[model samples]
Target: MWANLALSPLHVAAGTSVGNGALLGLTRLVSLKLAELRITDGDCAGIAALTRLTELDLRNSRVGDAGVQGLSRLTSLQCLDLTWTQASSPPALSSLTKLNMDNCKVGGEVALRVLRSTRFPKLHAVHMSMVQVDETGRELLNAICSDSASTLDSFMLPSASISTVRFIGRAVALRSLDLTGVKITDSSWGTLAMLVSLQELELRGTNASNEVIKSLQDLVQLQRLSLRQTRINDGALPLLQSLQGGLTSLDLSDNDIQGEPALQQAWGNLQLLESLQLLKTKVTDAGAHSLKQLGASLRELHIGSTDLSNACFLRACEKLQILHLDGCRKLTAPVFQSGVRHLQELQALTVSDCPFISKAAVLEVQKDLPLRYMSCDDEVLFSAKKTEPIWKSGAALTDRLQELAPYDERCRYSTDELLSARYSEFVPQLESSGPLAAVLRELELVSTQ
Candidate 1:
């Protein structure tokens, strides 16, 4: 086992305890991760001989300050993760460029001392989520932001307060910031706008002021923004529209946006936008109509849970590649024959839960195009609730349905001659099955059976 100690990466067992026999032979490993292991202070002494180690992760481990000290001898270590551990004091890691101490029970003073004394000139990213940040920690953060703003560009500081956010804004060089589930209000918008270099920002499950969108206007370089499950409403749409030119991806899913009039007015203005998600929004046919402006540019569009009819897809999304129309209850067969089938660029389509659509229409489109994926389950069962079978009796209709039922069970429509000869056997059944009532009754029975 000791013969291969010079390997580039070494992974040990999760249950491995301190002074385990397997670890005795490994000393020349370049990267070591003892995450979620029973390793303690004494075990770290065995790993101290791996001077070539460049990465170490002791996350969720029982390692304490003594174990941390033992591993600190690795002068070449550049990345260290002590997440969810009890390591109170971290040694001065001059060579470390990335450090994650999220959810650790470390005190503010110890963290401050490390941050102040640590001399990682190349340090570019840090994650301090759920870490207790006292006044000293805040000062330490401000010092890092002011002194090393140029080198540091990415930060993940979820649960951070407004003061911490203010301090972070001083790092003008930041290109990415993740404050998901963080608590901050509109008051911090001005401070946040200082990150002029941010290219990607994630604020999912976080709430900020409507004025926060005003702050985002200065982020001309921002290409991607995720506001999923946020409290922003229709009034904030105009502010979001300011990022039309440079922004390519925007996620407004689970928001209370009833309409997108600002986006409708600026339809073609967002020429660079490639992906837009409006899932679970209160968008209706009007909202879908406004999306026509993006049909030529957007590669992926999600309008699920919106109240749209077949008319929405008639605009012809010439460049659209993926479309999601789930829970669009108003859609029917006309959407397929008139609108959707014409989208030659469409590679994937989802229309689940649209009870007005027919399995036949979905199948026709599937056969016409080489669609990579198509979901149209729960289609309409009948032309309507009333009307009698054009056929003589209920028994005759049941026999015909019994024959078509086999293939229809797998899909909404039959793929064999039964459906292929719709003009002959199928239409006649619909015409005889009252084109509505009787045929649907049999279909319901077959499905239930």
Candidate 2:
């Protein structure tokens, strides 16, 4: 009966061959999941016929090389999760924007060659955690700095990768870079400074400090900079003035940043700043008071686990939208209720692990504000909506989504595979020259003289 209609996301994990026959006519299936499923050689192989599938999750499934070979032609495929599979050769994923191949195979040599920026030109996030690379010298870096360096917005490699790419300095067209959990080599500091067009740079959980800050002074065009959980201290705060004119979002969370004279002196320079994250830093009441100066433009803020007892700073940011107040022992209920009512734009609020906030106080504040989502001391993070399917709840999901689509073997290598297999004909224009960059650059060139 469900076969006549266009079906949605389907999951077939740890199930017998009962409903597999009724899953054939679902040509509009957008997402499919088979993670940790007990399947044989040709069990769910018929899923290769779903041409419109944009996302697929085969993580932890024992589906070997043959199973993934069918997915290589999914041109509309934007995201793929092949975390714990035995597939050696990466299928030619032409339109992939995000990929997770964690612990697939060590020394990902063959995978590196296929990881060319031109191949997956739209590739944004690549997770190679727990996988070691055999590429020495500049092989790993050069593969990333290919012809399509412009379209690759983000390259999140949170693994033990240490290499100095000499060509990265020349790739000025490439700006948005994420080197999370990868230690920056001493020699690479000079190379990083050459990217003057860098608007978004994230060095979260790395070994970056003032020494690296000196090289980044030339990044006046930088807008979004995240240095969360690094070795940055107050000494580097002075250099922030160089990029303050253009920077909108700045994060110095979990660092040794002491908020006092240094916070007011250096931070007061940022007049156009928007979102700020100072979670778990050494910011005191003096630093907390200074934030009101930036309240006009500041929209999102995360100041959890600080030594500030006062919640009066929340009264200033009338334009504030999202806020996180987790692990703040000093925040009392009366103080929070009085301060939060000022924020008319507040939508998302997180107050987890605050021993001072009572449930009665939370409901009282809810009356005055229009908070869409709240997370604190509850199993359910959001509301009781159950908006999206829980992918990991294998058997439970399969029972609810029984009539997704019928499986078939005849159309596995259909005409859709032939078309999406080829690489893009033209190299996409660099995002740096895109519309948003043009608008931002125009704003930076605004003069006060």
TM-scores for all candidates: the values are: 0.74, 0.63
lDDT score, candidate 2: 0.61
Q: List the pairs of residues colliding in candidate 1.
A: 388-434, 389-433, 389-434, 390-432, 390-434, 391-432
lDDT of model number 1: 0.64
Poorest lDDT segment (10 consecutive residues) of candidate 2:
422-431
lDDT of 1 at 432: 17
lDDT of 2 by residue, 369-421 (tens): 77765656442234322232213333432321221111112112322331232
lDDT of 2 at 348: 63
* Number of clashes found in candidate 2: 5
Give residue 304's lDDT in candidate 1 (0 to 100). Answer: 57
| 357-446: candidate 1 lDDT, tens digit per residue | 766667677665556555555333222112322323433343334322311332224223232232211231221112232354444322
As a TM-score, model 1 comes out at 0.74
